[model samples]
Target: MRPSPLLLALPALSTAQQQFPFLDQVKGWFAQASNSISSAIPSAPSPPSVPNPVASGAKVIADAKVQPLTKDNYQDVLKPGAATASPGIEEWMIFVTGGNKTCFGRCERAETAWNESTALLSASRSPPNLGLLDCEAEPVLCNAWAVGPPTIFHFLIPQPLADQSTPATTVRSFGLNRTTVTAPEIASIHLEEKYTQKEPYEGIFHPFDGPLAKAGLAIPVGYAIWGFSLIPSWAFMIGVSFISRSMMSRRMQGGAPAGGAQPAAAPAAGS
Candidate 1:
């Protein structure tokens, strides 16, 4: 193989230059070349340093239009405040799942979309009230609402009648995914009502109102019928036989009188 450039340059160095080792001079030359090459490439304009919009100590989602709601205050915020003469003004609210690994990391995108929707709605002249419930923080409340995590719910709640006695209210949910937001209508239950929201119920067995609940109940009933059908005819016969024998034994025992003596064998005829 041919000698390297460094070896070739070694022989060309003058006697005075050789006094300062050729290797040192070569290194210096390389340093200068590198600087030239770097400068020639137009050192990518250093990205202008940007000031962070939020303070280091600030909370996440501070600017979000979506209000963080809890179990205690959620009802008051979503429901009508006063007993109005006419129907209450319609309101819209969103339930979003976040924190504590609720949806296998899928909630991040969903939550982002929800926040964007809130921002969009807030700009409107008559923006509906939007409240967010974090499934991770308020799991019981989410369960009561029959809300599954990693999901976004946009509910259009029609105001209750002034004289409505029941505290319970039903809200209509619109079909919304990560990005879609639309007006809600009662007649569109088939197209948009993927899941029905059941307000929290304290009573036991109150949650068995869904189709899945019906299936759950039906499963047991089916199992019972199947079990009964499997019972052999001989088993029933055996049970009947045992009961009849018991009754007969009881009757025979009852017939034996309390005297326990034959009186005098009827005072034999010939004796």
Candidate 2:
């Protein structure tokens, strides 16, 4: 039977559907399904806003910069108002840090004590900024009177580069690898083990073996061949058969004549 008009129209309709599927109202069904799914779930509340332009700019600047610290460009990060000198910005903080491992423990104890002491301020809704000093990376303020590292000293920067009052002359320090100690000193001091950074078992190799990876991967590799000969694929089998057939002919041609015999010589009288 001949095809019907409706059947002939079906192909054109399918072609048009393939070109613009939305014309077939698939998007309408999809939108309805999406709406149903969305309506079933409770609406999410709006996110709170936090101004982060300065943060984004800082990130970009940090990414672009690789400036090495030198005497010429060293800035006093400890200064309370060291960020800018535009007139009235008060940046304040209690920096808790140690110069070394021994100092680190003391600073941590101090941090715990300070947290305990400031609980009242937190309850009253007034909390101060606190920072951990990166002792090695952060150069100490040159003019501040510090006994040495591994100590807690207080400082405030009221104005930009102004002759601020001298910082406290004396500060308490933690155990600094105690060079000499009496019986009384040994009795008073405390000690404990701290191993934050340590040597790794595998050394520095990563992603693969280090240094000798090329030597390790120098093995012969192929889809249809190995070190000695072609691997047993269809192409290899075909070539081997052809060479074998030619060699077989040569072998047959070089063979001794078939079905031929010679008479034995007469035995000597001694036999």
Candidate 3:
């Protein structure tokens, strides 16, 4: 016997409900799982390249442009105005006036002696300009004490005396000193010319001497001025107050006995 239509429909509906129980909860869990899977995948990192440590060192060497010292081009990197134009009185007396007039013999000997002496003593010598503590004498000596390149000697004579000038005549003389060094160390030396004119009224005037000549003297002047200027107004006021108080105390101590000091007590009111 076949079931009636309503009973058949009722049974089919019940089966569908039973099969679909907690359908919303299942859909929600499926959505959460899909989100978690999407979040679990990580983004890839950028690719890296190998580092080259020698590149920077090579660049520094390339930038240095090491070269040999020569007469034509030795002053390229030396400090400007390092070599004095006119020799000191002692040097002039030893090498110029006392030496023979021949440019090659006594002059060359004097130069050689001076170079050797300077190279040896420079390590222990102090800078003439700044205080002794300010300089690293050894480093300066090591850096500057090199034999100069071979140079031609030229003596300049005034135009008026050129016709009568002789080789023995004292005039301006110029020569070069040579030096050699290993790779990576470059030494440059220059003779900076400073002209001095002696006027009857003005005495000796060095044309090239500039503000650097006064830098040492100006430091102390500026320091003193700065220290005085920085004194606070309160300090001045306090000084004035101390002086005023001292004056007032002295006046009170020296004043006429406060009300004339009561007549010596009147002999003790009739002894």
Query: Which parts of model 2 are misplaced by more than 4 Å?
Result: 1-93, 99-108, 115-127, 134-151, 160-271
The local lDDT score (0 to 100) that residue 250 gets in candidate 2 is 83
Among all windows of 10 consecutive residues in model 2, the one with the lowest summed lDDT is 187-196
**Candidate 2 per-residue lDDT over residues 1-271, each given as its tens digit:** 9989999999998898899967759778888999999999998889999756744453343333212322223234433355542344332223333445325434434433333333322233322222334343433221111223333222223453457542221112233232332222211221111111222122111101223222332111211122223244787779899999999998986674555455568999977
| Candidate 2 accuracy as lDDT | 0.37
Residue range 77-173, candidate 1, lDDT tens digits: 6554433212554445565576745556555545555544444455556665556777677655555555566544544445545686434333443
Clashes per candidate (backbone, < 3 Å): 0, 0, 7
Stretches of candidate 3 off by over 4 Å are 1-21, 47-78, 81-209, 213-271
lDDT of 3 by residue, 68-139 (tens): 232223232122322432222111101121123122232333334333322222233331111010012111
Q: List per-candidate RMSD values in Å.
A: 16.1, 26.9, 21.8
Model 1 / residue 245 / CA error / Å? 35
**Candidate 1 steric clashes:** 0
Clashes of 2: 0
Predicted model with the maximum lDDT: 1
